[model samples]
Target: MELKTVTAIIGIAWASVITTSAQKITMYSTTPTERWIEKKYSPDKSPVDQADIQVYTDSLLQDVIGFGGTFNELGWDALQCLSAEERDKVMASLFTENGTLFTLGRTPVGASDYAFGYYSYNDVKDDYTMRNFSIDRDRYILIPYIKEALKFRPDLKLWASPWTPPAWMKVNEHYSQKSSGIEGTDIGHNQLDPNRNVLGNVTGFKMQQGYLQAYALYFSKYIQAYRKNGVNIQMIMPQNEIAWTPCWPSCTWRPEDLAIFVTQYLGPQFEKDSIDTEIWVGTVNYPNPDYIRTFLKQKNAEKYVKGVGVQWTGMRALPTVHKEYPSYRYMQTENQCGNAENDWSALENTWKAVVHCFNNGVNSYMYWNMVLNETCKSAWDWAQNTLVIVDRNTRQVRYTDEYYLMKHLSRFVQPGSQMLRASDKENVLAFRNQDGKTVIVIYNPKEQEYSYNIKAGNKNFKVTLQAKSINTLVL
Candidate 1:
């Protein structure tokens, strides 16, 4: 027989043996304008080159807990702009089991950077007893948002972190690191307690002398109070970003401070109170593995910290911690805030961010804001991206590209989904859900459509990827 005839015969045999679209796989995608747009395509059963992307079904990596976003004051304000029916509709989109079914949430312990104003649970000076601790602001704002979310998903889990300790607990007399410079508040000291109409004589600095115990008690009180209010907070991070020092309400803590507190103060205090909440040494934004290493060196450090929560630069330390300590669970505590464009470009960045985090052993991914209004403005004059945007003037809710980005992951990848260690030539991550289905997310960053290949178990298929699109393939 001629060589050409022999080659054609081999190709026909390969096509017959390969898995085709008849195998019944689903393709869901997101474009610049569309969110969770479903498409149908059959896998090519022909002989393909090795250059096509190959996903190995047997190579499982991590078990994903879930995907979610923050419940901040800014997000609350944006949510309130909509009518009650519209509000429920939006909440259902994010929290309901029929929707994204996001089971995890990130909440600020008191006042986060995106808080409406600077305040703490116990701002009163010399209030060591914490008799004045109250979540009145939360009742009016953050609680209502959380309560509404609970209506959609009663199983939502929350982890609380503080941007700073109470004003009297930090270095010198304030919660913020630098001066707001608006009169009484300065780098050296905060002038007075406006709520009490009294000057802040409660002095002496950052978790010093007797302040560590008091501040730890403050966290305990906040957790207890939230529990009393029907909010089941499951975890607590001693600090938001131990390395960050901003003019806003923030505190800069050394590695030892984190170690000493978690191992010595925070951990023991929670135990004494019999609080089931786990302590997390986060939402650590620092990238240095050394800081995490330093904390781990403390006696019984692992006893207190059940997980590591990282965001932004903290990603650098994540894989390292996971590599060294696989026993501890890891999470992307916060997604990087974008420029509030809420466009395809920003969503692409989010795609890369989630991929990177999951590839590095982060089991859960959390976005910064679920919704922000037209301004997308922060309390400190900054703007960041969000999943939904509300137009106050029109009272309209617009889902952004990032919303689809979240949808692509949340819709298909459920809690307890085991990520597959799929080798990627096509910028993809594959995972197997609890139901024994295979899911591969392909992110095409190129300017043109690219044809990719997948090899799962003994079956092989070919996929055509569009330019700059996120495609989820489920088998």
Candidate 2:
């Protein structure tokens, strides 16, 4: 499919007048040539066709936690390239009530693939006492980025997870699991000696008591330090992608070993320190259901885990895992990061991902890389897509198609909204806010414009959707 215009139609229907033709509805559309153009329409007095979509307001599902994106070091550095006023505008568009109103955010505990370089909170070898543990490095980049967002929305919920543990705490004694260069490049991504022990199928983290105990202390200190800095990290995932052994700052974990660590060390440490941060099992990137089961099936680990986070291939495991563990909260940890194209195809994939996760019972959804420089390349030489891009030379900021796609839902779907049942046709999603406002988001992929007859509660209305566009109707 070609990258075409996306038109969003927002309608407000009153409960009293919903069944009458006198009900006035407003429409707002975004096209490639024009963005968020407003028009007016009224309920059809006489209809010739059956309802194309049926919304069941009585059938409510998960309560939305909210929408958000990650705060990466590169994203922050990209914003630094823009003028102060431009930077503020971008921040406002992301977090302010007048904008997308993102209420949740994810931050890396230490170095992620997007970081300027590989490092950790405590690099001192075998510091079992954790006396050297400090977030002094975060003060330079991550902390400021998080603090700025808090300025716009102080209650913005934050979660954190590390790409890898400190080098000394790992069996490989390196920040990365791989000893070789990235697949397509000759550049070695880390300083791991090629002759030394490279992490294999085993858990990269040392399973000994001393390492496990100190690592748990690492997590507690992280939470305490962030709280001291006025940024309350509400959640912490044990690791980011336990199955993948990437050349970047990464660590692989056997599910059984992770279960043991969380059960005996991480969980008990948090309880001992009186830290209120919730522990979650994720951001799982593997497709195998056994990885999740190996963790959650352990009753002790399940006791401390409040939720599960899934991303990439892990999405395939979400259905099975969620089916078995329905009571646990679920989240789409990271949206698939495309190849920095930021094109319509990527937007379509994002929409499909959003639908799949919400339909499968995720309470919250998160996008990766909120912003990036024009090059879109990470410090480790990997290129990825982002919602906003800044041109370093021109000092210009541009919001990609994904940004508007996110706004179509996040701007209308408030935090307390409940997911309402809607017919599976036409890529439709329905939600009802706490204030009794109903929101229907639909996408028309056909080349020809189609008119849809919608049934909500006892009321019925018709909306004509644009060709190859996404529409949001609010009532």
Candidate 3:
């Protein structure tokens, strides 16, 4: 994780200080609250690493103070989707114990479009019969990757979701990769469609009244399988992007249908199976407050759902939703391809995605496909748009500016740490925590350099933000 560094002369009143991206420290005070820059007192300083700077102060230097929750939804599918050799390089760059890349990831239950090819955990006989199911797919690679990740953060929280169920479970008679012959007919557990060769061999499962119960059983099997392999899942999104009928590995459900399935069947099934994982609904692409309203408005919605997961255009509408459902926690589940021209438009769009969601009460933000090829190829034909891209030709993985920008929050702002409010300062985004610790992450996505004042506690610091650059200051 080598960063670009330059010796720059920065001033604080009559004092001049040398700063670099590698090592930096800036101080400001309208009225010096107190100064303690030691290895132990500074919240930013590392306790495990013996040689890092520490800083501390006591008292609210300013009155404009606020805090919110923080978490991440990073990607791990690319690792599973790529060839073993290619996946290794991606892991080396991002999944290390001290890696600067990302910690959290999103994984599929079955063969997602991003995977090397189509497959599932239990590919044994009677996949949908719920009679003789098994998880053989994980032992070779998936579980190993998870074990390596646990070495970094033993308590790492994982949020699991599926793009598509097994070929035996869909009403269309096959998983996403295959074409649907019959439009609206239910594929029963005993039904085997020989014509759907797209998925190799798909014996479509029955969509009987007990389908929800069967789904619950499937989920239980998945949890048990992963647990046996020593991975504890924290949460699960009912389905990914349930609004759109995707080109590959997709499922669609109306808001009312989702509410009913979750509240009546899935929720109760989880309780019965003793699976403590939290159930999040509406992994919708955009923030459709109407959809959220539909779910939350369900007679006893609060009892069944943990929170709402949204992405894309939906994130833009969070402020309005936050005001209406302040009680419900919202999360930016997934997003990608934000004009990767390495410009402010890209930076500003990413910033807006983060701060807007946080300001409007979103506790977590995760990007799509954490690491991609140098050319950024995908089964869906998606291109290079990851925070980190692994170049196959050179066999070298490169980090993007977005990686550093996300670190401004993901790395510094620990889980359970609340986000505090300061001011947006037009382009500069500001947030603080309950402990009065503040992280003002700013980016000059434009061509011209800009300056802003961040007044916190009794301090007013002038920030000179360079164009197409990112800055994060803690006070």
Instruction: Identify the leading candidate in terms of lDDT.
Output: 2
Q: In model 1, which residue pairs have backbone atoms overlapping below 3 Å?
A: 53-453, 59-421
- For model 2, how does the per-residue alpha-carbon lDDT over 229-316 read when each residue is reduced to its tens digit? 8889999998998877778888888888988889999999999999989999998988888888888888697689999999888999
Candidate number with the higher TM-score (2 or 3): 2
Candidate 1 RMSD computed on C-alpha atoms after optimal superposition onto the true structure = 6.9
lDDT of 3: 0.56
| True-vs-predicted CA distance for residue 380, candidate 3, Å | 2.6
Q: Rate the local accuracy (lDDT) of all candidates.
A: 0.78, 0.85, 0.56
Residue 123 error, candidate 2, Å:
0.1
Best by TM-score: 2
Which lDDT tens digits does candidate 1 get at residues 156-177? 8888888878878765566665
Ranked by TM-score, top first? 2, 1, 3
CA lDDT, candidate 3, residue 32: 13
TM value for model 2: 0.93
- Give the TM-score of each candidate: 0.88, 0.93, 0.73
User: Positional deviation of 280 in candidate 1, in angstroms?
Assistant: 0.9
